[model samples]
Target: MELLSFGDTGWGDELFKATFMTILVALVAFFFGFLISIFIVPLKLSNKKLLNYLGNTYTTIFRGVPELLVIYLLFFGGSSAVMFVAKIFGYKEFIEINAFLTGSISIGLISGAYTTEVLRGAIESINKGQFEGAKSLGLKKTTYYVFVIAPQVLRLSIPNLSNVWQLTLKDTALISVTGLVEIMRQSYIASGVTRNPLLFYSFAAFLYLILTTISLKYFNQLEKKYNHQP
Candidate 1:
């Protein structure tokens, strides 16, 4: 309809941009979270009690907290922490955290918690004989992980990682509270301005459905590719 037209007469451009932003946020957050999980997974798998405890604590806290709460804490508390550190250096200016960073980091922390568990399961699923076999082959630690362990872990974990990606995509909606102009935020703004909440919100839902369906297809392809690997 006219309400969804491009340019000043409608919010088509805004919605389009917002959809892109949503994708960007989800991607950055998911990758960031995966990086975090890479570090935490070793901690959890370590034989040292302190290392294992620390990893468990990180995952438990992040997993137990609500995603919205995590965003609020990162958005508000991050600025305060930065300012505190700045003041300690005799600088008194107020600092505001970037919305994109806050959103990504918050979602990333949550995503990492879930990813850590998924990775742990995948790693544990690997047979003990593989480690012995790699050792007998005189492979270096790095080579063993890269060539042997990594591939199987990735293959086994792809299915669960797909779920994590979907959850991360949905979680991006919570970042709207940070005024990030993502899909939900743009829909809210357009709805408020046009007084057609149903139209814009429905459009937002459609956009999300498209994203999820495409992601599902991609993940399915990835799984098939990995399954075919010898």
Candidate 2:
């Protein structure tokens, strides 16, 4: 209890703030990653062979690579890559990306890779007859997807997206390597300073469990709500 107290003598405040950072990182990454999946899924499903191949290559590469390595590359080498692009445009200066942006982009890219497949599979699972019916009703393309397809796609994909969310939440721990003060990083510092590894580590575990519990319950509610659609 003393170790979990919220004051200077305890590591509680730091850990609590770090947990918030972890959640924030995961939330932003999830949103951006899902948006990325929107584009990538269509690219993979595109009639053009080039777009299809590019999408396939993106998913293949990101999914094949380790997430940690992706983080390292983004944090360590991203500036150099940006500088190279600047030179091509007749600019000369060092470029730097902060840890927060680096972590978000790296994790989002990784999540986007897996999400592409999930969204594509969900859309494909919907019956062709549904689309045909929408078309026969003279629904515009936007209206067709918005009213008829998007809801079902989201309904079918929520389970997989939840799994992906869990994976992303845990992956934020890897962001600590880039010097972001997330849950695992805070726990590491607290344990080292207090010489109470067991206590701090356990606290970290409890926090993670809380995060997952809330996420699962929320997704389950969504599942139930979507399931009852007319």
Candidate 3:
């Protein structure tokens, strides 16, 4: 109890801040992954073999690799990659990629692969008659997608996206290896300092449980709302 106090006497403040960082990183990574999925989805759906092959390869590689390895590779190699580009442009200074960006990108790449699959499934589940109906109505391509296809895709995707959100949230714990002071990192620090590993780790787990529960409830509400729509 004293160990969880809010002042300098305890690690509560640090843990609270770490929890916030966890949420921030999860949100950013999820959205960034979704952005990546947007481009890849079309490629996977395309009739061209080359484009489909490229998209499938991207998803397969990221999904098959270990998440921690992805983080390690990106964190260690990102700066070198940037510096290589810089030298090509005649700016030869050393570049360093911060832990936050590295962690976010690594997690985002993984998330994107899963999201692409979820979205692809959602799109495929839509009845073919909807497309034919839209075309028969003489709707422009852009208008048809915007007003018809996108909403249903979103509605269909919400449940799976919720799963993605949970996965992304849990994945933030892995970013501790990059030295980001997320929940796991903070817990590790506090445990080492206090020699009370069980307490700190349990607290960290509690915080994560709270986050996941709240997010699950919110997604359920969203699912219900969408399901009720005409």
- lDDT per residue for candidate 3 within 107-188, as digits (tens), equals 9999999999999999899999999999999999779977988899999999999999999999999999999999999999
lDDT of 1 by residue, 21-94 (tens): 99999999999999999999989999999999999999999999899999988888999999999999998987
- The 0-to-1 C-alpha lDDT of every candidate, in the order given, reads 0.94, 0.91, 0.94
Candidate 2 lDDT by residue in tens digits, 1-230: 88888998777798889989999999999888999998899899889999999999999999999999999889989988888999999889777878889999999999999999999999999999999999999999889988999888989999899999999998998998988889989998889988999998888899999999999999989888778656
Where is model 3 poorest over a 10-residue stretch in terms of lDDT? 221-230
Q: Could you estimate the TM-score for every candidate?
A: 0.96, 0.93, 0.97
| RMSD to the hidden true structure, all candidates | 1.2, 1.7, 1.1
Rank the candidate models, highest lDDT first: 1, 3, 2
**TM-score of candidate 1 relative to the true fold:** 0.96
